[model samples]
Target: MAERKHDRKFVRTFFTTPTAVEGEEDSAKMLRGAVGLRGMKAPDVWVPDNEDATAPSMRDEGAENIVEVVAENGADFPGEIHPRVVWHRDSPATRYQGFKHMLQISDPERGAIEHIDGFVIPEVGDIDDWKKADEFITIVENEHGLEEGSIAMSVIIESGQAELAMGQLREEMGKPTNNLERLFLLVDGEVDYTKDMRAITPTGALPPWPELRHNTSRGASAAGLIAVDGPYDDIRDVEGYHERMTDNQAKGMLGIWSLTPGQVVEANQSPLPPENGSWLLDVGGRKVELESEDGVEIYDGNRLSLEETGDGYVLRVGGDGRELDEDELREELLDMTEYVPSMDDIVDSMEEFEAAKEAGRGAIAITQSATLRIDGVEIDVNKDRMWDEATYQAAMTPITLFQDVYRNRPDQHEELAEMYSEDVVERAMDVGA
Candidate 1:
């Protein structure tokens, strides 16, 4: 069937970093470089299943920098999930941050994690997919020693089926428990999604994929779930990867997948829009310079102000006014300015994200549950959950089982707003608008 224009759009840019366990040398290099990321914050490492997950233990390097360790079941439980993961003899490593399996939310990993944070579910195309996920979760708790809603389950929106199923999916979001807390949207399952959209006419480079990406993001935003961007496989294409990530950032993706150590700096970077700058304007080809105090108005309308600091000249905007949302703006500014992190050290990229967060510029990532305003719209987001209202109501589940930080504390609002800002949030809200 043909698609419509009013599809849901992606809100936050999510970078689901994937590393191929093949070729020991390359994997090691990627891991080493990733660990050395400027801010010392490691990228969200995705160690897929059907690989050498047990041996070598990528756990050490991944210990600190890891955000969410997604054991993608797609590689093993391909096409569709059947009941639950067979849970081979192996599969350990519990001490990572936000550790969970990425099986289809429709089915449980059974004994995958008797006590763990979360799991993954692929190709969540519609309400039925979630309904099936709900059923599967029930089976796990009743028969497999799986505590109801004890583990957080996430969803991946790949393929045309999930796109078509968006409307219905929204209606059935929380499920029988209303305890369903968070939904993790996999970055790019469209590699498989395009295959599913076979019936639709090929719409050139940006087919159902981009639209599908936009829709999933919007759905997640509306539902207050986390939407991650798909991985960029072509590793060596450094500049190309940055450009693609820039595109995703434009779409307001939370974080982009980091394939190699080199890409980490780029992924950690927030969009550099020149809302206020003579330097940025010049970099953007506007060639504007401040001659006198009267020239300050050159950046009028923009909430930016030019100042100096230990790190060369700094452009600080009063509110969140934006200038250039393109690489030329940042590149030109970086080239024109004497910002630190020198030529030999890419520390600028590493420290830039953290620095931005500290300056109240934007969020490093959506590390917790908070309300995000994308384009003046408020989105209530939570990163954890229980199984369902039915399960909770039946006393089969514990309401306070998951670690959600704070549940509606008035004081935390300001802190959360600073963590996940509107710049990143606004990216997706403006989709199609």
Candidate 2:
């Protein structure tokens, strides 16, 4: 993977606010409001959108709004600002228009270039098409006297050739010059991709293209860029949005596009680790949690069964049963239970392991115990999780995310303090320091 160029720690939410509203008397009212501190609360990357979100008639005014609003509030905004410029591989006219907008917004006189992180080019086609957009930005940088490769280029993967070019990104890293290293993110546009593929769906709706999301995640990882899922059009379906985020999180795509402020807050917090820890049982291929009655853990799931034999208790897993003594049964049951650590639990474990490593221990074992009752038979189950250097590094991911959020979104500090407490937040901020 190529090294990233910018200083953004992580991008959990990429939010795009429309630059102009058709009926609104002040066309740039939406853009002006979105650039304020309250409007830019949770998103790590905030975009003053000048593309599809705005109509063609208002785009010229929209560009001026981006420059004006960003100049006024960009200094106080916590997130990185990247305007979405209009571009199409098929039309040189549209591409030139986008280039002109980039020049207008990026001119040093505007005072918005310092706050702007990059530009998101949409409707990108093949590798050569991608290079043309990059070249335009290079010229804009030279024309504006900005440093070479200062303005990053992020492309949306909305076409088959663009998706295929992702695999070729590493090879084309520094062919002509190191400008490609200015690449920041690989965003997905599933609506256009679906249209491009001519896919027919039963409901006449956009298909949930899981393979496209997977490919985007893999491609971004291979090229050392952030992968962001496209926006969910149904803004009111909070539960559905969470489900999609959970699925995307499993694929290592932590970033998601947010169209509304409510969705921005949801997407920002969805990728972080759970606030509390819980235990889950792996039954066949599904994860089921044990039920608790009074003070005893009860296992009454259909996938698992317990039988009492004359010799001993027999544990049935799916369709297989094995006779085991009380101690063996407890061991078997504990092995089936997986402990998902909460953010606080992870911090505690990492701190303990860090101290151990400082004291010359190569590896350490931590014991976690739970009590459960099976068919009137009660047993104490204990399991040990071994932690090494690699385990500690892996455990730091959530902590690192917390630190990034706490640093970038001071507006969310009180919420973070309430969720994880001030002490844990302080420790998180000091983890890598």
Candidate 3:
């Protein structure tokens, strides 16, 4: 017995010719010879729907080995194709379900389709038109659990109405959900020269030309994932495409894709970095370092110092050592300063000099005799009377004078008033001539 060939051969090709029968036969013959099926069992051929008619004998001769048949263009077959062929249909329900089946069967890695997936064409004009689209999105989220930033969806912008409604669509889809991530914009329709003409070259002599303007209007939050699909004939003529993309990136756009591989390459090359640390504030010139009693030193780059004031720590800046009147600090200070007594009230209790004399306090005498006058004097007085009345009056006289001066003519004695109490003034007045 001859040994069978062990080598396995595979052929891959696409059928684009108009004659489907010839294409299928050619594909089958190519595979049969490559797989060594001349004398033994013949190899099977797999042809897409367009080329299926060529293999008339395949149904009887090679049906058993034929693994799968894919229908390329789904437009012709409504329900004839396999239930598994994930159709890109216009019906939202079917498309959403088909997307889920594709995910399950494809068993793609998590986040694999996040950067590339499907598109969503939002309803234009009245918001009521969007009710169906929103409901469809909710179904995708609740039933499929797709998650934002995990899949891409594009919106078709074909009409003037769609352009006007772009803002509303962005706002509605800007939130986090397990439906999809990103939005790709598709601009369709022709430029109307009569309505959209603009003067060119700025020469004022040249005739005006129609200007084509299409935009990917994105939400402030969704700017990062915003993109525009294109194969536009006049895209190269657009003055601000690159600038718009740059601005979009500044507003947090990840990148832009115009559908084709070339566009994808260009967009991916200029993608914003995944994580930007640009917002970290620099405090080199404005910072201050403080050492606490616990030996814990803190370098406050913002110049905010926390120090114990009364009940809590007060915030102060280092330069002028000025305490900040933060709301909390003010509240704490208000609590602390309540019911505090002044220095004058504390010192007014002193009554008599004889009492000080009894307590062995020495009196200071003037070096030279000074002209002094006594008022309301009754010189003849008993020791007890002198001690009780005269000594008390002498001790308190200075205090009384000081209070009178402070109340009557305080402008001249502002400094003295600040430093010394009323009792000190009264004593000085009594001793003076």
Candidate 4:
């Protein structure tokens, strides 16, 4: 088989192509928009309509009925084309040949069709059902000569039963460790899951839905599956949309389903690391130097107040009733010092500045785990907090001193030989530190 990028760069932000196969023109128009969206890594070729639609009949429904609903709407199994085709070949409910032709005929002209990254199977209820779908994929490969194992395989953990049986289902599917390279867990089908659990909420809020979402993510992580969060129901609630996407990202979900182009940005976004900067902090009437991450905040409090002066705003220090003009604040003349970086000791500020450009901040990394007592709560702010609180200075100190002391003293070096005791120098010079 030809090398596929899926093993390296699998889908991140999934764009479910609009169910376009109901009509060729409709399908093309919708898919064009879906694929064209910015930040869209890939989209599933959708099989639409009865995608988990519970039958309205007052009788038991079977996989046979599902095959009919899928066949009625099955124009292309881009989502799981092969398994779907195999499932309905002898059922007589769908014109399976026409579906295959649609994929073959329509594929070449679809502008971004070549970017099809994977297949998705929705409404996966039981082990036998998944196995049949798996067989369909094999059949497609053997008969149609589609590239074997080219695209990743994914399933929506939508149905309640599916959520419970996910592990067993994967085991039965025989997704080997190698084949697991390109795998996915799309957390969706909350609506039907609510129905299955007989769960209800008059407020239409996800009362118990968060548990389902977490379970999907938890299961996916346990099984080493890439967890893509399902789509948000309402597109217009932009703030809520962002919050929901952020929530999923925090849960370690890889991506979220995008119904609109706008949601893509939020789904792909990572939270901005906390901004830290040097500032003059007055402690006990002395100039005490402090860094931003030391729980010292200059914003919001009795520290200072702003007032509108005729043309501009004036910052007045609170309680002391002193006011400073812009020029004085910018100058280092008065007890005010520029925010000196914690790394300023490693090299001259210029050298430290250049080192930042040379080494990516995430590189030259250290993993430190520590616990801090915050407001009576002992919080373990281990590596993650350190990662956030890290300033370029603290990270640069060890490198210059350790490499056989290869770093020549900067031209503007300060004579700080007296600052270190012999052991301190030894440790700093890799004797122990």
Candidate 5:
């Protein structure tokens, strides 16, 4: 993939705050508050939303507020600021309104253009619709005397045509008329997408369209852009939100639309490697993690048990017991055991492999074992994982993510230091250099 236009390597959270807040005396109160955030509360990409979040009657005032507030606070803010402008593939007036806002915000005389990173065009349709948005941004840059591709354009995949257009982005990038290379993020808008699909759920809640998320991630990977999941409306359900992030992370989508600052902190920290390693046991095809007590691995679950017998001991797995010798027990445990390495463990393994690579070794196998005592019987379990050049390169992802967070978010430095210590953090910064 070609190098992307933007310099942002980590966009773990995309926070959208309404530019205008109703019932508040100061219409720009929310925008001011979002812009003034610092430390862990600040999002990776701060969006001053002027579309769905703001009422139609107040959108004009909201646009002005975005320019004013962003100009004042954008310098101190540590994240990229991309304001969401109003646009629909079917509505010309809305597209024009969005165009006018971009012109207003991108004008150098307004004092906000220097602080603005880009504009997010929502409700985009086919490739032509995307090109229209790109053309608008290009015109704004030329009209403002800015660099040709200095301003980035991110789109929300809300319609079926937009979803299909993602597949055609690579071929379309070769064209010279519009600056399609300025595309930065491909964010999911499941609410609108569901409406577009006419999908219905008994609970009336939005369906979890896992296929759409996978396609978005795949498209972003193919086109070299960032993929972000849609918003989780239940802000209070933190566990559910974490589960969503976990699922998205598995699909290579690290970013999510955060509706609040509290959610921003969660999303920002979700993609990093765990501070400690863990062990997992397969219990009837489901993986169950064992707990640690004073550095000893313990499994108190009822899935596996040990019974005394005259010969030796009977191992019961899922209520099925059979007499087994020591060797059989070891083999059984080994087959069911899985080792999940921590950040420290991965670093140590990578460092060892790097030294081996220096010695001209192509691959190496590492062993991880644990001893668990259940019902007065002790059994040892070990699993071997191989590390090659490809494995080492893949393991470097979390380290690179840590480096990006360390570089872009200085406000999060203190927390990172506490998680992995100053020494580890310093070493991680220098890794893959």
Candidate 6:
């Protein structure tokens, strides 16, 4: 069989920093220098200073690629320039100050989907509050007409609650919206197992084992979450770091942030191969022998021969096996492969997965479960489903899961909007309209 090819997409990093009028030219020079070093053009530049003078100055200095200007505390800028630049107000206490800023300009109708960053704010509190935060997110989504996969929500998981609520956070943020597309759980700051217990135990329960110091909380439910220790920490040599990240991908997280250039290069280079192998097929309780060109063959009582069909291969089973439907037989064969695991591969995969899982647990523990109700479902730390390797990978890469969810449960979009407040709704409308 020919090897399957996987294409990796590179995400551009938008750097954010405060600029001063005196240092405007120097700032532009530094930015251009940084751009040169990163081997890319600047996507957007955030001028934190609220003064109107700096915006025009930066614009005049050949920083024409600057897409938006962000200010803290809702400070307004001069109205002389293009209305394309958006203004956003955010609390300094939240971890997503930069994300909220970029989201203001993220309008799918305008074809403005770009990767951006938000400064990580260190805030401490109950991890359960992420549910309410999810509610706040819904408000933002409703107001802005944000839809799932429209704009990515990258939360800096600095607190215990932030880390604990990652799963639920992703789920809530991932609700279908007009503009939203991806949700990223970024574990920023120092990876302190003691202080940030939310990463260790997302559910608000005592440690599963007494020996485990960290208890679980509500925030750790979403699978798309990824944890990088911190900007200051050494990026190259963290324990179980790659597995923790891959585990997040397994859960549904697409990407992580705050990584240095070297770290980013390493992550993009990791190998992920498809699980492939041969398996025995039992069709309608009848067995058959299928042979591969590679000389690998499994035999059952029923005789099966492969005949070349136009543009495809067909299996003639049971000799007189009533001319099988081609589509049905193909489906059955695919299903059979999943059930029959290659013992050698499974053993090797499990060994690596176990080591990574233990390291992930040591660095950050996840608690997850699920419940179904006719009226509505309630998900939290205690009520959530724990993520095994497979589930973790699925949650981390939400593009895949989002497609699945939209196909499976199209009606859940409205429920997602109801979680937000009026302010968010108004903001969403202002931008989208």
- Candidate No. with top lDDT: 5
Q: Across residues 186-234, which tens digit of lDDT does each residue of candidate 1 receive?
A: 3456665765666455554434356666775676556655456666767
Q: What is the lDDT of residue 216 in candidate 3?
A: 41
Model 1 lDDT, full chain set = 0.38
> What are the clashing pairs of model 5?
none
- For model 5, how does the per-residue alpha-carbon lDDT over 1-433 read when each residue is reduced to its tens digit? 4458887765899999988887899999998888888877899899999999999988899999988998888888889999999999999999999999999988898889898999999999999999999999988998999999899899999999999999999988757776898999999999999999999999999999999999999999899899999999999999999999999989999999999999998998889888889888787898888887665677788888886677677888887888888888788878877887887887788888888888999999988878866765777776778999999999998888888888999988998889888887887787677
Q: Candidate 2 residues 74-115, lDDT tens each?
A: 888878889999999899999999999999999889898998
CA lDDT, candidate 2, residue 424? 78
Error in Å for residue 16 of model 1 = 6.5
Q: Can you write out model 6's per-residue Cα lDDT over 1-433, one digit (the tens) per residue?
A: 1111111121212122222234544553432333332211211112222112245444332222323222111122110011112112224333243234334434334332232222222332333343333334445456667552322333344455544454344334434431222333343433433444543557642232211111111232324233332332345664444654454454333233323445443342222222233434455465333443333344433354444445544555555433335555445345433222222233333344456676775222332121211112111112123446664453333223323222332242343234333433233223211
TM-score of each: 0.44, 0.88, 0.27, 0.50, 0.96, 0.34
- Candidate 3: lDDT over CA atoms? 0.31
In angstroms, give how far residue 9 of model 1 lies from its true place: 17
TM-score for candidate 2, please give it.
Answer: 0.88
Q: Candidate 2, which ten residues in sequence have the lowest lDDT sum? A: 33-42
**TM-score quality measure for candidate 6:** 0.34
Task: Write candidate 4's Cα lDDT for 1-433 as tens digits.
Answer: 2122232222234444333344243333443333232212223223222232222231122223223333433433223221211113123233243234224422333322233444566655655554544444445444544565554556776576677766563454334423433444445666656666777788966553677778777766666665666667688888887777667656655456655555544443322111123444443355443333445323333444444345433544545444444444323123433342222233333243445455655433333333322122222322312221245454443333222222221210122223333343333444112
* Local distance difference test scores for all models: 0.38, 0.85, 0.31, 0.42, 0.89, 0.33
Candidate with top TM-score is: 5
Provide the clash count, candidate 4.
6
lDDT of prediction 5: 0.89
